[model samples]
Target: MSATDDVDRSSWLSGYSDTVEALPIELQRNFTLIRQLDDSAQELMDDVASKSLCLMNQKTVLSPKERQQRLANIGSLLNEVLKRGEEKFALAKSTYDTVDRHCTKLDMDLQKYEDEQLIGPTMGRPSTGTSTAGSDKRPEKEEHKRKKRKQTRGRKKGIAPEVDEGQQQGEYLSAEDAKQHAQSAISLSNLPIDPNEPLYCYCQQVSFGEMVACDNDECEIEWFHLECVGLRTPPKGKWYCKNCAELLKIKQKK
Candidate 1:
């Protein structure tokens, strides 16, 4: 795996190892206390058992005087056992309390570290450079609206059309002839024109309807005056009206 993967895995592994290792050291101290208490209790129990056995033997088979003496000895040993057991039980309870307190402290420390590392960076604060104050602040809403407007304008206009790098070698014509030819044969598609637009006559230099229609006599479109056509230059070489340009793109696709 890559270095990043190794580092991520190691971070988690190390944290878990630290937590587990801490428990053993803590448990060791508590267990030692528990063992000491148990040893004391066992010693007391052994003393009581040994003394009681001696007393029984004396009463059953030895003289009556020896039995009385052995009875006192057994009673003393029994009292010591009971006393030792109580002391040991108290010590074991104290050890448990100490271990419990330590564990609680460790848990709290771990929780604090977790909160600081995981939650702090995301929620604490935004970076200074990422935000601005007062009227200079750019509102997110306006920024989105600006982007949308730019995209809409882009959709309306194509990028600068490609111009022919080399000059055309086709038959040359006088400016007037070029305009006349352009006017006569250019029949437009049935697309409607706005009536208020001026229509120019190719021969008479007269404008009629609000459009420049071509002179295919069968055509429904108006023609531009020859002078008007010559006066209007192509943007570089490629020339098309808004609707014609859109149509050209569709034809190119086929």
Candidate 2:
């Protein structure tokens, strides 16, 4: 190899060694011990083979009893080596399993901490204004105005306002009435499913039940099962998924 190539290789090796050394002490020690054990095991096997060969080449003629004793000794030595190797493998596997469990627990705890921070009690606190009470009530008023504005816009566009089916269901209606109600409601054509997409819902893999399509024109998630969104029946009129609803809210604010 060229001198420059050798220098580059040396530098890479040095960096890799530093990275390994920066690992947790316990992990580094475990790796070091495993490497040493592997090397020792290899040397031992080599030594056993060499010694056995040397013994076989010896000119000393052995009786049947002596030959059997020699074979037994070699077998015992090999068995000991195998036992030691097995023990080392078991130890390494156990250490890895313990580390994996600890990592999983740490990840879960970190996620919980993040969630708590995001949804803290003070997150939506109103800023100071002329009066504390007025400021506190301002958010509720703004929310009401936003809903009214959305309804007004829907009416202007000749679209039926959204309604929660779960809340609006009245006393028993006949099947014929129900069918008529469904027909009168805005009809959303089924969006074509992608050829590569799975036919079943990712959340629950069963027959595709009553489905709803997002009203948003630009949403990539064309359709999802009503059950997947915790709805027994499709909502009346225009429907938007939670994500699309949030987006529309932001757009309105802007």
Candidate 3:
């Protein structure tokens, strides 16, 4: 090859220009989805922790309904966490399978190229590519199987790494299991909140400090935080959140 071609190839070998095509578009898209799902799941976990802390507050008095509401929120969060975990696992598994297929293809292609380049009178070069491809197929298949088993053999011999992680974290698949865990955790702290019931706010947070209640009785989530509404204090007269105001306007026109 020319000197320019040699220089370009040498640069690639030195890893100076390798990143541009390092990942395929499909893999990049999958990675983005994975990260988004992970961030959302982490936020849900934080919300669960924050709500749990609220339930543990000894000074704050919550009515039966309010307490039930908080518990119910935690339960919903636990269910969502499980759902996200399962989704991430499935997506990762699909990505793994795709990579496996690509690797096997790469192996076969390499064998063909090697057979072509090493051209000589080795049992006739016309059928050499076919012979090499055939010979490499069994080894490629066996290597794929070996790698799969090696990666997954740790957790009960066939479970994926993701499954092993979930098992290690106490197997909390639903709110019921979480509620039980909370019960055990609360016994020492003497927290009165059950891990089940439900609440009313756009933020899904415990009603605290200063909050404004919508005048409309029909409002699904009747409460709003002053900070959330961009107000320092409650409105002087009847205050309605944006949704409640729209509903009231509709009612007035009707």
lDDT of 1 by residue, 52-101 (tens): 76665654577778777777777776777677677766765665566566
- How does each model score on TM-score? 0.32, 0.37, 0.38
Which candidate wins on lDDT?
A: 3
Q: How accurate is candidate 1 locally (lDDT)?
A: 0.51
TM-score of model 1 vs. true structure: 0.32
Clashing pairs in 1: 197-210, 197-211, 198-209, 198-210, 198-211, 199-208, 199-209, 213-222, 213-223, 214-222
Q: TM-score: which is higher, 2 or 3?
A: 3
Model 3 gets an lDDT of: 0.61
- Candidate 2, clashing residue pairs? none
The candidate 1 region of ten consecutive residues with least summed lDDT is: 208-217
Task: Give residue 38's error in model 2 in angstroms.
Answer: 1.8
Candidate 2 global Cα RMSD: 23.0
Q: Residues 141-190, candidate 3: write the lDDT tens digits.
A: 77787556434432222222232121121121355644553454345234
TM-score for candidate 2: 0.37
Candidate 2 Cα deviation (angstroms), residue 35: 2.5
**Reference-based lDDT, residue 120, model 3:** 30
